[model samples]
Target: AILNSCEYGEGWATDTYEKALKDDAEYLTTEQQAMIKAQHALLKADHDKVKSMHDTLAEIA
Candidate 1:
């Protein structure tokens, strides 16, 4: 259940960021851009961690 929530949150954040980048980049303040980039980086890190966990579980099984 927690994993599902994380996946949903990540998907929503990714979609929102992509839309902002595609549709509003030119209008965004520098600080806003930096914040979005930081969010993206954190999301990517979470994804990588999940993938690593899956790989380790696969190896164990």
Candidate 2:
């Protein structure tokens, strides 16, 4: 069977760059840092909208 050929017998292997380095450090790499920055920006914008909505609802209540 295919599982017989695998070293881990069908289990996952850490042959990929990301998987190999994932545990080396929690620190983000350059590309990951950029993506994180973009995510932060979007979250900040969403948070501002939520705050505005709450304020408006409070005023109406």
Number of the top candidate by TM-score? 1
* CA-RMSD of model 2: 17.0
- Model 2 scores worst on lDDT over the 10 consecutive residues at 7-16
In order, the Cα lDDT scores of the candidates are 0.77, 0.48
Candidate 1 error regions (>4 Å): 1-12
TM-score per candidate: 0.63, 0.54
> Which segments of model 2 are wrong by more than 4 Å?
1-26
lDDT of 1 at 17: 82
The candidate scoring highest on lDDT is 1
Clash-forming residue pairs, model 2: none
Residue 30, candidate 2: C-alpha displacement in angstroms: 1.0
> On a 0 to 1 TM-score scale, where does candidate 2 land against the true structure?
0.54
RMSD of each: 2.5, 17.0
